[model samples]
Target: MTQRIRELLDGAVADLEPGVSDPVAAVVRRGRAARRRSVLAAALVVALLGGGLAAGRQLVTTAREPAPAGPAELGRPPVPRVVGRTVVAGAMRLPIPDGWTAVENDPSRPCGDLHRTILLVVTGNRGCQNASVEVYGSERTYPGGTLVGDDLLDEDHRIVTPPVAMTLRGGEPAWMSESLEAADLAPDRYPEFAFWNVVTLPWSMVMLQLRDDGPAERKILDSIVTTPTEAGVLALPDSARSVSLTTPDAKGRNLPAGAARTKDQRTVAAVIALLRAQSDVVDDSAACADPGRPRAAVSLESATPTMVVITLGGGCQEAVSSAGGRVRLSDATLAQLKTLLGIGAR
Candidate 1:
């Protein structure tokens, strides 16, 4: 069959004129066409291989990288530019750090023998673990001298460092100590530093305790404000025109006629002195008796009829009803006032 096709091709070529049909030209054209086809096939294969390589590289890079951080993973909340703000805690106004939040004692929890007359606990979310500032006062009397050596040591608290003498805002003597053991009331044993300010007015001791001795803690301690005593409030010029003490009779009725009213300068001075020796002003709203049926009443009349200051008492609980609001009085302050008025102790 090959021989027969060759003979046929030769016969067809022989029939044509040599100059009209050129076999060499036709052979060269076919050769160029085959080379072009081969080049086009190779180019298509290379294009496909390069695309696969690029996609594989992208997948590998993505698997090796880490996920971005979220808000919680960043740790602490941002601190505000301003540092402190004055806030009223009980009767005393104090300055607290800006980002810190106040945590009040839970009323439902039992506080046995813990005379927290003015308690303020503050905490902040600044990356420090278990950091807090606690300011409180106890009803028990603390000796004037070295608090860390005398009081804390007696209580079995292991003092990690020596106490440093310092002065509070009003020139009151204070002692600071760092300890390894926790307080009697603490839930856990943790290292702590404390500042004890000895005050005579209330015959009680005030304390500020911090978990960590960091710069943030120091800033908060520096912002503390000295609160005015009850005597200071009463000593203001023209505090009251007259002061009276009233108590309930056998029938639980307030005896106006039997009440003692004192306008004498000497008696007023004595009463003021007595109050100054006792507890400082504190918020007593939570412990006050009913406004209508108080156990005892100490009324201070001013020139203006509306400016009357009435202090109602029921046992250790006492509230001062004034224009601002009804607030609790310190225990010692109420007790001393009762003694001066000839009202028997509860």
Candidate 2:
């Protein structure tokens, strides 16, 4: 019985020691060692569980605590001085006074279209009182012999003075017309002189109209600085022979597969004229890289191919060119070009 018990104990603690010459004594020693190891393992497990519970409770407490408050954010800065500063209205940038505020017409309105008319109203107290200035321009060219003075005159309203020839600050010829009555207004209620100074340009016709304010309006008119015409506006390279429009392929290819030649001479001439009359060059260097494929492309066949790549649809930049030495087209110029190309306006 004693031998059998020793054998059993020796087998249970066999993992503690592999080799044992004295079976009984080896079993006794291994049994004591195994008991000690079990006690140590139990103590280690309890310690780990206790530490984990304590850490978990600390995390819960931290999460339940309220966050501290912070200071409020600062407000936006005040509007800058407008005196002697340039304010952009459609394609042209006009000078405005410090006290005057400019308001653009709604884009949905007929006069708000940049290609048709760009109307900007300048007011001193946000009302059409005795002192107010209105600036108007258009991208479309007027008919030949169109009189600016005749355009301002109306048979319904009172005429303060007849149309007279005037000279702008740069010696440019202008027509000055004055009226005692205002459009859609009563003369007795608003007894103000309506003054109109119309100037014609190759690209568009601009008019500066003031009501009952001569000196202030004249000062604003004198401060007007027209945008300079960029080079290569009218100069078409002699190397250029033909122009063509290319559309993208439906199979998601970058290659110009769908090519269509534009043989309409009148359309081509209109496009050229519009390009020649571009008054402003907008900086589009920071424009986002369009991920979508181009819609249409205008290629000018020359010794060195001068191309104007266009990408229509939403969230796309206007005409862009991969060819070097191509001028960047402004919004108005791009719209005119697109219209001439039968693409219509955006």
**Model 1 TM-score on a 0 to 1 scale:** 0.25
Residue-by-residue lDDT tens digits, candidate 1, 218-333: 45445554332222222211234445565445664443333465554444444434433333443322222322333444444443211112334344343332221233356555
After superposition, the stretches of candidate 2 with alpha carbons farther than 4 Å from their true spots are 1-85, 89-92, 106-131, 139-175, 178-190, 193-204, 230-346
TM-score of each candidate?
0.25, 0.25
- Report the Cα RMSD per candidate: 43.9, 37.2
Put down candidate 2 lDDT per residue, 1-346, tens digits, no spaces: 3353334335433332222111110000111222343434323332432222110011111111111111001111111112235554322346656655555433333422122122253211212222255454321111111111122232112111212222233322233332112231233333344323233221213334454334444555566553322213233332234445444445532232233334344444444444444433333232322323334445554433334444444444344332211234544554444444444221
Mark the 10 consecutive residues where model 2 has the least summed lDDT. 22-31
Colliding residue pairs in candidate 1: 284-328
Candidate 1 weakest lDDT stretch, 10 residues? 21-30
Whole-model Cα lDDT of every candidate shown, in order: 0.31, 0.32
